[model samples]
Target: MKYLILGAGPAGLTFANMLLSSGEDDFLVIEKENSAGGLCRSCMVDGSPFDIGGGHFLDVRDPDVTKFVFGFLHEDEWDRYERDSRIDLYGDIIGSPIEANIWQLPDKKQERFLHHIAEAGCNRGEPMPEKFTDWIEWKLGLAIAEDYMLPYNRKMFGEDLDSLGTYWLEKLPNVSYEETKRSCAEHRPYGTQPGHAKFFYPHSYGYGEAFIRMASALGDRIHYNEPVFSIDYDNRIVNGKYSADKIIVTIPWTGVREHIGLPGKLTDSIGKLRYSSVVIEYVPENMDTKAHWIYYPDPKLSYHRILVRHNFCPGSKGYWTETNLTRFDEDKAAEEGRTYFVNEYAYPLNTIGKQELMKELLEYTASKNIYGLGRWGEWQHYNSDVVIRRAMELSIN
Candidate 1:
């Protein structure tokens, strides 16, 4: 069957790659931007490469996904490194997988924190938590929920804890009391951390270079700068020009439903989905940070995380920091002598009832032979690896 893919990002590219491997050639990839990569796209400032969308790292735990991604780049084209990630909390640099390193806090505070966790462990039979706030307290106890989880998430999400869903917890690691005590006693933290403990980065070009290479493999299949303003679902035509028997959309879900003229019920469900925009600040490469990225849990700071890009690859020539904000003042950043790039829809919100709504939307679209793909397209918070794997799974099924 003829196929139309709405984006050339990771998900779209992965799906297209799968089709090519299967000898399915009747397909086209339509990208709105002048290039590929979607949110993972790259840009340059002052001759320094910066991932303006935020820091993109390869730390996926899935072996198949790893092999697939690495197939696009040569061995010499990339380098591997252990994660030098830390958190800047209360002006102290704590090893990341924060829960595992909580012992680094002051002795008095650590005792109190462990006491709360002990209490929480004693009450393990409590009912399941429905909201994000309750889930944090239930999982990590009141102390961690108050000191770290609540405020940090509030800043990142730009919303109250109660308004969000607990599914985003998948991105976080869960540490137990025994794990923490052992880590503390041994003076070595993060023994049980999942992915990101070790990762890889490209030796040349921007983070989007991998996706660009994948697009290059397809040769003339991708049509860049083709902004799809409207999609006629009834006739299965995009912008009144391209027609296909099946359409796979990797674009953000917000505009697609309206463009296709879906009914009010589905539109209402689409409207409830929320997103967080990001502002990436460019700084000197020599910034005083040995860590690849540092998380700021303090509410006083405007930015939640600062990524030291140079640390990831010493030849990159600069650093980029990311923060979620409703509004980013360019003048203020300029006044502070900083250059920045704003990326709208940098993160997907897992607000209450979001899972159900996304399921309903996917089902309705699938019935019409239209599939949603990727982080934004699926309206879920998925990492790059998961996005590619999902695309491959969809192509096969």
Candidate 2:
């Protein structure tokens, strides 16, 4: 059966690759941009290549997806490194996975967190919180939630924390009062805590290089710069008469709703979805620092994160001098006494209303045989591995 895949990002590309590798070659992949990679694409600025949507580390623990994406990387092409990530909070560099590094907090804040832990431990089997606030209080207690979690989330999501659904709370690591106090008293860093401590990255090219290789494998099967403006669901076709036995759409759900001429019921709900726009700045190789990625939870900074491309691959230094990927105009950057290229993306914001809207969109699209996968398409937050794995599952089923 012929298949038409929309949006040549990771999800669409993964689905195409899975089907083609299975000896099913009658599928077409369409991308609106000049090339693929979507949010994961990198650009050159002043000879340095900067990931427009921040650097992506390939930390997926799933072997099937890992092998599928990086299988072609020669020994020298990939680098296996332990994660050296950190968070900047209140003039202090706290080890990443902030929950475990309570010692980084000032002594007063530490004592407050300790008290919160005590309270939380006593309140077992309480009714689940209704809002993100309640969940934070229940999980991390009042102190950490008010001091760190609340502010950090507000900066990241660009929305009130209470509006967020509590589904994501389970992903966070929880520590009891005694555990936190003991760890702090021992002066242990948060990095020693469990989950996602070790991650891998490509050694030579940026992470986008992996996707570029995948696209190369498909060769002529993939079509770039083909923005699908419309889909005719009444006739079960796309772009007004491009026929396919099956359609796999990986574009943002917003695009899908617009293409299919969704009715008022669906369109109204879909409109509630929210997203955060990013501005990436790629500086000169001379500006390279020790950080792989820096998280800016403080609201003062316009950008939420800053990443150093050279940190991922030493060879990337050469590219830093040739072009500007950070989207900052050379003359403008000079005027502002800055020297980096910047690129940005509007990330999907997972507000409760938007979450519900996304669920409706996914269910509606799935019912029509037009599977929606990936972060933007499904309106769910996901890393690269999650997108690839989900697409593989969808393609196989």
Candidate 3:
């Protein structure tokens, strides 16, 4: 059967590669942008490389996905480094993967956290809280929760904390009262597993190089700058133009439904889905530092996070041949007088009712031949590795 995949991000590319490698050659990958690697793409600016979509790291533990993607790279092509992330709260730098590094907090804050942990430990057998505030309070305690977690989450999601589901805690590390206090007293920050903190980065090119490599492997199967305006679901085709036996869509669900002229019920459900828009301001080389990623939990900051590109890939320096780098709004940027670029995204904002709405839309869409995957299409948040793994699973089968 012929397959038509939409959006050239990790999800679409993974599906395309899997199908082609399995001897299923009759497939096409469509991307709206002029190139692949959607938000993960990187560009040169004033002799430095900056990833438009924050910093994406490949630290997946899944062997199947890792072997398939990185198998092509030579040993020297990849650089494995431990994650050195931090949260910039006011002027203090707190060790990141935030929960594990609570000891970095001031003595008063530390004591408050310990008390909450102790209370939580005693109440471990009770039912977990449903709201985000309760989850943070229960997990980190009211003091830390109110001070950092809640405010940071609000800034990130652009919504209230109570709306979010507590399920994400599974990916986080939970510490007991004794452990937290001991770590604080000893001045030893709680460290996560080495594997979790370590990631494989391309030594020479930016992370986008990985996608470019994947596209190169596909030969003539990939198409760029092809914005699919419509899809004929009844006819099982794309743009009411290209005929295909099966369709795998990875674009925003709202856009997909608009193309197909979905019914009111479906349209209404899709409309309820909310998303956050990101602006990635790329600064000059001098601004680049050793920070892999910095989190701004403070609500005062307009941007949620800032990433340093030069630190991630030193080889990117060569690509910075141009003295002038493009800015998002030249007029405004000129006012500021700096070389920087920004990448914006309408990513699904997980609200209280969003999950349920997405579930309904996903169920409705799945009944059709089209398979929806990835962040916007699935209406769920996922890392690059997770997106690729899911796409691979769909394509391999």
Candidate 4:
């Protein structure tokens, strides 16, 4: 069967890579962008490479997946470094996974946090949470939930925590009482999001280099700047010309639904899927910080996180900061002569009923021999590893 792959991002390219390895030549990939690497792509900012769509760190725990990804480049193509992430809370810069590093706070702040932790049982077993907010409180207690998780999530997700479900809570670390106490007492690092303690990046180019290399290997199989005009699934026609027996799509559902019409209820359900956009400000001068990225939970700060690009690559002279706001104040950026890029769809939210709706949508698509892949198409808050794994799994199948 001739297969049609949609989008040439990591997911699409990885899937295509598998197809190519299997000697499958009939398949074709169509991408709206001229270049590969969807949100993971990076660009040059004044001779220095900077990530235009926030941070994309490579830290796959799966050995097989790691082998597959790193196989694309020579051993010397990438550089490895331990994660140097921190949080800026109440003007204090502390280790990340803030729950495990609260002891680093001042004496008064530590006492207050400890009292709250003790009262709330230090993230022990509790009833299942109904909303994302409840899940945070249950895992880290009211002190952390209010001080960081609640407000920070509100800022990051661009919605009330009560409205979002516990779909993505599994990503957050859930340290036990003993571990939490030990971390605080010893002032030792603890409870990092597993597999993120260390990561690798390209020594040259940017995070997107690997994907670009893969696309280069694929050559003419990918059609660039070819926006899909429509999809007539019943007749298996794409853009009124290309026809396929099976189709793999990596574009957003919002984009898909417009082309392939959906029923009112399904459309409405898919519409409920919310996303938080990002604005990245690329400062010309470097920020004097050793930490790679610092979370700004205080509402006082307009931006949420500041990512020092130089920390990842010494050649990179400056940093990039992200804000949830879409319409960036270009005037402010121009004053500092900082260039900024805005992405309208960055992080997808698992709003309440999202799981059920996504299930329904996928089932319907599968029935039509249409499969969805990637973060936006799948509408999950998946990391790069998860995205690559899904592509690998689909390729062999």
Runs with alpha carbons beyond 4 Å of true place in candidate 2: 120-126, 189-196, 256-263, 285-291, 315-346, 353-356
- Model 4 residue runs over 4 Å out of place are 121-126, 171-175, 257-264, 330-337
Clashes of 3: 4
Tell me the lDDT of model 1 at 325. 59
Pick by lDDT: 1 or 3, better one: 1
Question: Tens digits of per-residue lDDT for model 2 on 1-397?
Answer: 3898888888888898899878999988888888778877765555545565566777747888778876655546777766666667766667666667778778987787788867763256577777887788788777767666776677666556666788866766665667777878988854344434556676656667777777787888777877787776545577775678778877765554345645578777766776655445555544334666656566554455556566666666521321222222457767887644333235666677676667776687667766768887787778888999999998888
Cα-based TM-score, every candidate:
0.92, 0.86, 0.86, 0.93
Better of 1 and 2 by TM-score: 1
Q: Write the per-residue lDDT of candidate 4 for residues 331-369, one digit (tens) a residue.
A: 777797668888777888788888888889888878888
**How much is the lDDT of residue 199 in candidate 1?**
77
Which has the greatest lDDT? 1
- lDDT for model 1: 0.80
> On a 0 to 100 scale, what is the lDDT of residue 165 in model 2?
80
* Off by more than 4 A, model 3: 119-127, 160-163, 191-196, 257-263, 285-290, 315-331, 337-342
The Cα local distance difference test for each model comes to: 0.80, 0.69, 0.69, 0.79
Local distance difference test, candidate 3: 0.69
Give the clashing residue pairs of candidate 4, or none. none
Ranking by lDDT: 1, 4, 3, 2
Which parts of model 1 have CA positions greater than 4 angstroms off?
A: 121-124, 170-175, 334-337
